[model samples]
Target: MSQRDLAKHLGVSLGGVNYCVKALIDIGWIKAGNFARNEDKRVYAYLLTPKGIAEKAALTARFLRRKMDEYDALKAEIEQLQAELAADGR
Candidate 1:
């Protein structure tokens, strides 16, 4: 994605996206290549390496687990509040 698009979607600064992209390229996690946009200009494309794919999978798993834990906590809290309300009404 373009750095500007990425930054806007991520709700971060454009510079932050540029820095992260540079770091990923430096670490060999992603590669950047220029594609012809027209006769006069080119656009950059970023491709993920195999290592980057693995890392993304790992990160996704971690994020899923974290969100699941949060969901469980919130569910428990809601149930507790409902029980308290029921008791108070009785």
Candidate 2:
């Protein structure tokens, strides 16, 4: 998708997408190339680089681990609370 499409899909403003994409481009996470030309020659397409793929993989793992930790903590707390309530006969 183009940056416009990405912004709309992400429910953010175009400027937000531009800022984020620019940062990623600077870090070598994304590449912008000219795919086809219209009446103008300023259009370009963006794709993820190998570095970006690696970053995505690492981010996914980190996110999953954090989510699992949160889920486990919440679940254990709920169980403890249930047991306490049962013991109190309420």
* Candidate whose TM-score is highest: 2
Q: What is the C-alpha lDDT of each candidate?
A: 0.90, 0.91
* Candidate 2 structure, TM-score to reference: 0.76
In candidate 1, position 78 carries an lDDT of 96
| TM-score to true structure, per model | 0.72, 0.76
The sequence of per-residue lDDT tens digits that candidate 2 reaches over residues 2-88 is: 778899999999999999989999999999878575755667878889999999999999999999999999999999999999999
- The candidate scoring highest on lDDT is 2
Give the per-residue lDDT of model 1 (tens digit) for 47-76. Answer: 999989999999999999999999999999
As for candidate 1, its clashing pairs are none
lDDT of 2: 0.91
Query: In model 2, where is the ten-residue run with the lowest total lDDT?
Result: 34-43
